[model samples]
Target: MTQDPQTSSDASGAPASSRRGLSRHLVDIAPLKASPAFARLWIGGAISGVGAFMTTVAVGLQIYEITESTFAVGLVGGIALVPMIAAGLWGGVLADVFDRRKVVIASSLASWASILALVVLAFWEQHLQGLGTHAPVWPFYLVTTVNAITSTVSNATRGSVVGRILPADMLSRATALNGISFGAMVTVGPALAGVLAASIGLPWTFAIDAVLFTAGFLGIWMLPSLPRLGERVEAGWPVLKEGLTFLRRSPNIRMSFIVDAIAMTFGRPYALFPALGALVVGGGALTVGALTAAGAIGTMLTSLFSGRIAHVHRHGIAISRAIQVFGAFAVLFGVFTWVGMHSGHAAGEGWGGTDFSTLALMALAMAGMGASDELSAIFRQTMIIQAAPDEMRGRLQGVFIVVVTGGPRLGDMYAGALAAVTALWFPPLLGGFVIIALIVILTRAQRAWREYDATSPTP
Candidate 1:
């Protein structure tokens, strides 16, 4: 039998006598040992992801501080939607046309520059406050929107490069490892943002993100050049149309996006964290950070012990089931928030005054959401990476990014708008049910999607 490249090498990159031992339940780390380049990319991306998420939390907090309104906080995502969509589409085409390494490097630089801009604006805001003047909020929105665009390009290109670097058998394992990257990003990042913002200020918080971004730069810089594999599509509406055309004909891929859209649109409750912390759950910035990190904790744990799942071939059913569980957790989160609000807990002091019991319950619910969501994401990503042709992978990943990023923004709007009219708890309660109902309907309508097998991906 032909020796697989993965098991052919030991940690020293020498020939090995036998395959490395693997735990049945722990995450498979063979992919890392097999490819040094991927390991670097993964580590760099994880570290940078931490910083990026920090900036995310800071920006949201900064907006909330300026406006003191949940809708305004949610508007941050709403404002970036169109530009981000354009960036995903354009970036996808760029990835398909240019050297993917160069595309990622350029986009990463732009994203880092945007973070620096945030640092500058943050300092400017501090200076203004000293003079009894308020800095304009538009700058924050503008900078974050630009960051969103650049990051989308960088991310889509990076995602596309994964399949190129690793063999098909390893894609699922790599995707699971990505969950760890995401976990680090969200779990450590937001929590640190809260501490830093509370202890130092927003300027320094933004500055730290700027500093940490360099690690990601190094990772992308070291990658081998990856150019188009076949006839490169022109970077324009035509290329986009081609991608859309592909999607229209591919039911499995289409259903994956659809199911994820349903989950993110209704089940996402992130936009409400600021308000929930301030008025409902009453822990302030600390509460917000904890709430955000809780989901990542669940994600990290799920990824940690994903060994058995890597062997599973029934991806479509796994995705559907995972998302349904996510919806249930979202509903539980709402329930906890409702109970906390009725319990008459006053807004606590910054980080120290949180209602620990109530916060714990809510965090548990959020963690459940994170675990289920990550499971579904793992399968969805694996299907895309394995099923799509190499030439079309970039474009397909672009559409995937749109759904991944856009769905949450729409959810932000939904949560924000609904909360604006009703109580803070109503949106998630209703949205959760909506998510469950829609997933059931959508899953039933597409039998092919439900029966999609990982071994024979049909995108």
Candidate 2:
């Protein structure tokens, strides 16, 4: 006979009432030892990501060495934004429509080819065409542009694979794990690149990236075959239109992109680091590099204990809060910079002069920026991966890549323009406040997103 309802507490004692259900939901998550495939992918990605980071730092140094123009340095992302978008979006549709594995493999190969080409160019040019000695801008632009496009495709396809390989329940864990891998790369990659560039040569940097390509191939090759979605649709505007249509109806995905855009547009201030390091703060190029790497360190620290993050269900809430916190950190960074700059004016006590305390404070701000950004990024990727279907995950992820990659490019312009017109520290401080305001403004307008449940399907 069934026990009397009155005798037991909390809704018939079904062992799955809201409170207990919530507890069980949290109890389940993947252990690192479970999936060797995931483990292998994570390891390979970590390795390749470091290589990518090396290439990133190398490119910046090379460009600066060649042109000695901040504007040219900004152009790296600015010029590539369009093709990256085109390739990323189209690549996403292809991922959903074709075999995601093949798409990733092909893109990886293309990226590898570009890196190898750079190595070759460096070899011949250093001796014959005078690469490092003379600095011809054309080849620099050509190889980098091609590399950016291929990398976008590779990025989108890899995201699709994450959704496919991991079950829905484990997406957050996988995403968190990926963050750790990415963090490792970011932390190690640039430093290694800087060391290698200074010691061996830029050509060797490119060569290193070429070697890393094989690891990515191993990651992809080990994956099981993934067939395209059964549905056949036209490739061009219609497929793109489909992605847009989904976003239009999906308040969560839509809001995530919109808020992130707002944050980037207003809060992003990386472009100012070099300027501050030189004219405003006083450390020089090495200091700028330190501030850049500090963010990666924050990300690495967050990933070290991502266990608690998996239990949070109100992810939208998490996103909004993390971003708000991020904005605050950015604002504080600017404030510290401004105060330090003025404080060290004539007597040389602060950042602009000979103030050691000033340098430490700036480093702290940069570290805070890194921490806030890492948390936001973890939530951001989770929303994208779990919300979209496998078929369209690639395209959606592609759009995400474009958003992230493009956001800073716009920030570069914003920072450059504002700094030229105003004071040195104005951009980050002013932009940080704007980010806070815009996030409030944007999120208040989207109630549907706030109510979105990750467990449900998109209508």
Candidate 3:
């Protein structure tokens, strides 16, 4: 094994895939030392992800308790979309123009600080008389906004770091590891958040989130300094324009974004979880935990042995197939829930978890969706990180951040809107089918995406 400064040139330059021959279709995931730097980052990310999950659950629970409306919870996520996108793009641009490590550090600190603010609010709720008496929405929105912004920035920077540290050959392994971390977070964080919120109150969850963010900071701090990729530019619209221009030239990348957006917008079923848990699923909060955890469990299972995917040169095709699987699962999830509703088991009104007895079926559907999503994510993330130029990584990341953040919100809108007109289960049932059909159609229509070889990428 050897380390060379000139390796990146191979990634971007002509002969297309000198990293591994086309014949080398698979590799052992564990032996790919890939980069120790990335390994450290992965560990830190897992920690932060767990805490982030806790905060997410806490925020939703608190909001639901305060407003007693599912709409409010969905609204919080949708409202934060703009700032998150802006911060992500800006953060990516900064990563490209400045030291990525520094950008990550600053943003990580900001994220941690926001959580600390949440911590303070928790104590205030417990101790301060006036502060706790009048529960305000603005502060909650503000803290959430700050958290979203910083989180996007941090993600963009971290992604850029992945592009830098790992050889092209091991991207799948890296992607798999990322999936595992996220899976673990979802599996661990939400359940913990629910318990903490139930027992210790909401503030403590935020405090835990603050502590978790620190692990990411340490990972970034420990990294060797890296120069900005490509060229440097001023921090405003010019940088943004450059990134957009790059995206425009690349049909696959653009299409990838569109595909993800569609799936997220229509097929996302998160906002409906509470409703399903209460009215249809037959369990209470526990059902929600099981459903969500089921999905994470699916993702974790896939990721555990995903070492073989590193050999795949055709990432585009992989993503397309994975997304279709995601859609199919979503449809199944909806079907089971819909069945529960038709069986005269509703929380009596709108769709709340209706049948706690049906928990197993719901969990299976959620798990399917989870597996498909994780697989799709592995390819999508790899494409984004490696294909984009180093100079515009930040801005691109910002855009990426928006897509990631807004996808579920769109799903929320899909579920909420469809539920208003039709039924709670209709959104996923219909949305899932639509997603699978569209992703398959789109990928087949676009041959370039299918041929997007990771080793020697065509941008």
Candidate 4:
């Protein structure tokens, strides 16, 4: 029941008696006003996330353009999976063993260097095409894989440190704010990348992403030293083994991961976007950007009104219900895509002439999925961060990152492979049904997870 010294003051950094009333239904900004360090960290991550998302859209599009295969584009996530998992595991151990601030800064630099390499190769490819030969696709894959490895380390290190800076009561609010940041990243980044890639080209698009990454440096660099909080653990096999052992013992924490994997593995439809834009939905890159951004709009709207969620203590039930809604929306999205395909909409000039009516309906469905997913994520994150003890938080957070990230990679494969055999619409339609059924079965079987109460966290 002890609190973080950094969050000791009221969120406004004012004496409790003098504070004015704030809306309970709005996103609480107290975390920002209460701790200068958290504010800087949040700001830096928010700015940098925009650039990261931009790079994600650009990379996916580039691969699709090169191979003309949705499966190849989906392979981007599969390619990074093994390396990212290793980095996330070892990075968690490193976070627990060394200074977390330094770990993040080092990883950030490595990630930046990888992005710069992308910029160089992009321009080089442009030059090559102008003369005779085109640059090899292997280099792009290699650099992105390296970036994924570094990014996993940075994410694990940074995620583990948030608990050190914020009080337990504010954790929910902090997560909600992160949702807003995530919303902005997806909303702004993909849209901008689509415009830039269509107008300027990939070289400049990559260069802009490189420039934006600098903001993250200020966030991690300015944080106070964050060493391990409890019993010391070295980075080795024993530590990794210990982390897994703890997860085995904690059913609630374990269940959180399982449910998320179900939702992401079955419900995610991102891998289909490039193909939809190119063939089914038309408007190419613009359609891709709009479809991606549509989900963010829902995420942002949900987060903005998240003030009331902090009062809810039944996090497990809340997570279960939210993901069910997410599945329903996924099914809706599949229906829209199927309808658009059957309607025989003429392909536009890659940026315009999209079937606005069908696109709008699909975007609406995607937005619903985003909102529900964000709600589930807030509670899942809060549950993990709050339930785990100080010494084990790093490792648990690492696993959380793995589930959060790895599931999507697997989903990319699922969607890509299924779409390859069937049609783009079939994966989401069938997957959505699977997610809804699996979540219900899993939660019902895991009684402890279904009955988890936030007021008395068991992990």
- Per-candidate clashes come to 0, 2, 22, 0
In model 2, which regions exceed 4 Å deviation?
A: 1-31, 120-133, 232-234, 280-285, 339-356, 455-459
Model 2 residue 287 CA deviation in Å? 2.5
Look at candidate 2 and tell me the lDDT of residue 241.
Answer: 82
Taking all chains together, the TM-score of candidate 4 against the true structure is: 0.94
Model 1 lDDT per residue over 1-459, tens place: 546745575333444444344545678788898788899999999999999999888888888888888998888889999999988888888888889999999999999899999999999988988998778899998998999899989889999999999888888889999999899899999999988988898899999998899898898999998989987556778877888898899999988999998889898888898888888767677888898999999999999888767558889999999999999998998898888888877777575667778889999999999999999999999999888988778888888898899899989989999999998888888988888898888888888987888767897
lDDT of each: 0.87, 0.72, 0.74, 0.87
Better of 1 and 2 by TM-score: 1
Q: Give the TM-score of candidate 1.
A: 0.95
**Which of 2 and 4 is ahead in TM-score?**
4
Measured against the true structure, the TM-scores of the candidates, in listed sequence, are 0.95, 0.85, 0.87, 0.94
Any runs in candidate 4 off by more than 4 Å, and if so which?
1-22
Better of 1 and 3 by lDDT: 1
lDDT of 4 by residue, 75-155 (tens): 888888888888888888888788899999999999999999999988888898799767778888899999988998898
Scanning candidate 1 in windows of ten residues, the lowest lDDT window is 10-19
Clashing pairs for model 1 are none
What tens digits encode model 2's per-residue C-alpha lDDT throughout 78-193?
77778878888888887777777888889888888889888877666557435336657678778888888988888887888777676666777677777777777877887677
lDDT score at residue 31, model 4, on the 0-100 scale:
81
Colliding pairs, model 4 = none
